[model samples]
Target: MAKKPEDKVLAQNKKANHDYFIEETIEAGIVLQGTEIKSIRNAKVQLKDAFIRIRNNEAWISNMHISPYEQGNRFNHDPLRSRKLLLHKKQISTLIGETKRDGYTIVPLKMYLKNGFAKVLIGVGKGKKEYDKRDVLKKKEAKRDMDRAFKERNQ
Candidate 1:
């Protein structure tokens, strides 16, 4: 199957995949201030340490950093404020259920612009143990070796 083209990706949490097994991903709209949107469009956002949290029956993205717009002046928004995420009620309920499980949490996988709006791809992930990470690395190395051998044979 052909992979779909990605939207204009603004930021990604590379460590999310390394530290957790992402079970499911959901795209949700973000509520951004004027300067925040400008900053996002400039690709000055960071999702490295961002995570999703459910509070008062609403989903919020905490610790996501969107740098202040260069010319924003006094109207610039905070870089580290918790931003609200827009999701359907049923989706929020499901996420709440999933996160209640031990070691399971909501993580922001990527942030992107879709149709001039900022959208966040959040995932339900379970934390990986040290052994699990090592096993994954070993499997990846084996796959790389196999692919290299196949290329040599074809050559």
Candidate 2:
């Protein structure tokens, strides 16, 4: 058996994990302009403050900032343009239904290249409350402490 090639990650939204409880995740293709793809290939993209929205039965990603390609000049794409997501009709319908519920949202977790095309990992997530964020932080701290103690004992 042969191992599969790993995806080349372009950008990731690290804050998404802290702000949302991801219930499910799905990979979807993105429509990019010429310069946009070039910028992405150079790993000049940002997923912070980016989110997915279902409108008219279609999925769109907004607020994702892809820096303009240095050589693109006047043909550079917009940094914060809304990009269409390619998902099956069934997947779109399911997302629509799930997002109708209170506190549920569609968020972009990461962007990566698969094969030769750009793909985004979107998640169905529920908003985290203040207390929930605090709880997660506390647990992370506890885990870090335990790992440190274990390392010391082993040493």
Candidate 3:
């Protein structure tokens, strides 16, 4: 599909990928106010400390910061308030079950807009052990060295 610039990423949680093994990700709608959307469009958002929580059979994003809109008055939404995520009932149930298990969680990977609507990329993730992260780092280093060697050989 063609990429939309307005949907051009507002924030990405790259640390989530490094710290956890993301099994699957789904595009979910976000409930936002007019000012929130405007702030997002301006790229005044932070997702580093953001996370997903399952509550009352639903998912909400917490700790995400969308700066205040320049044109907004008191009606502007709070920057760090919990925002509900729109997901299927089945998805929520599955997440709740998996999260109840050991070392599993729900995390937000990315945030963007889809067709003018705010959307979040939510993932069902399993936390990686220290050894797992080390192994991944080693693999990345090996790949980088291999690529360098291959480039010299080709030249």
Candidate 4:
């Protein structure tokens, strides 16, 4: 197998996990202009508060902010405009079918440069309830307490 290119992951939507349960992930190519690609390469992209929606049998990502290139003059793409995601026919069909269910959504989890091109990792997720969030918090706190207790006991 070929090696994956080394890219500095610019941004991630970590809160997506805390707020929703990720069921599946798919990497999709993004349609970007020249300056938008340059801005992403410089780690100036925001994946937070971004989401994907299927419409007219295609998926569109909205609210992802790719900053304008510092040197670009009158050719900069809009920072928060919707961007199209390229996915295979089968994947799009499957996503459309599954997302039709209740509480399922398409969320952009991360953005990274792949083979010198921009790629977005989209996740199929179900939103978590308030009780679920509290449970996760309680589990995290318990794990931390356990780690501290073990260290104290060892010392």
Candidate 5:
């Protein structure tokens, strides 16, 4: 038996889960400039505030911040440029249909290097209300307390 190497996660949008209810996620390849890849290899990427947009039957990621490579100098790509996402026509259509719904949006969940190429996990999320956020937090706290009680009983 051989162990498989895991994909190296570069950046994650932690707030995505708290801000919206993720319905479905899709993995898509990203078009990156030369320097962008180098910056990602060093984990100099931020998925916070990043989102996906579908236009002209194409998927694009906007607001993803990939820091300038230290050695790139003039060759460094724009840190906040919109990058194309490589998804099939079927997937793009699915995203388009999903986003047409009220309060539904496409958000970037995670970015990582898979097989030496940069990929992003995008999700169709529906916005949550203020009360929804509070409910989630309370459930999390209750789970933590329950776990603590269970541990004490075992001890």
Candidate 6:
């Protein structure tokens, strides 16, 4: 069987996993300018500190940094700008309803190129308390220890 081509990931917000308890995730298209797409194709994008917001039934991503293309000249796009996210009306409505709940927000988990189009994987997340963050770290440490022990035993 032929191997399937994998989607190219441009960037990921690793902190999103640490700061939020993600309940659900969905892929959405992003609107990009000409220079923006050129920059994305070169893998010059950052998802750190980026978040999604719903306003007037439209979803927008804020704080996303797509570096300007080196050769873009005067047409270079802004590095940090709010970008529109494309989703179905139903999805937008659902996201709006969910975001209205206390402590619930939308976060972008990853950015990737699918079939030559830039897409974002967004998640519905709730803020985590400090204690919760510590607990997660503890669990990760335990898991790592177990994995190491198991590997030694198998060896």
What C-alpha lDDT values do all the predictions have? 0.90, 0.91, 0.86, 0.88, 0.90, 0.89
Instruction: Specify the highest-lDDT model's number.
Output: 2
Query: By lDDT, is 2 or 3 better?
Result: 2
Q: Which stretches of candidate 1 lie over 4 Å from their true place?
A: 1-5
Model 6 misplacement above 4 A: 1-6
How many backbone clashes can be found in candidate 4? 0
Cα lDDT of model 3 by residue, 24-93, tens digit: 7778889987788888888788888888998898899999999999889887888999999998898888
Cα distance off (Å), candidate 3, residue 37: 0.2
> Which 10 successive residues of model 3 have the least lDDT summed?
1-10
lDDT of 4 by residue, 1-155 (tens): 11232576778899899999988888889998769988888899998899998989899999998899999989998999999999998999999988999999989887887777788888899999999999999999999999999999999
* Collision pairs in model 1: none
Question: How well does model 2 score by local distance difference test?
Answer: 0.91
Candidate 5 wrong stretches, greater than 4 Å: 1-5
Model 4 off-target regions past 4 Å?
1-6
Q: Using Cα atoms with residue i matched to residue i, what is each candidate's TM-score against the true structure?
A: 0.95, 0.94, 0.91, 0.92, 0.95, 0.94
Candidate 2 displacement at residue 142 in angstroms: 0.4
**Candidate 6: lDDT over CA atoms?**
0.89
lDDT of 2 at 71: 99
Superposition error at 121 for model 3 (Å):
0.4
Clashing residue pairs, backbone N/CA/C < 3 A, model 4: none
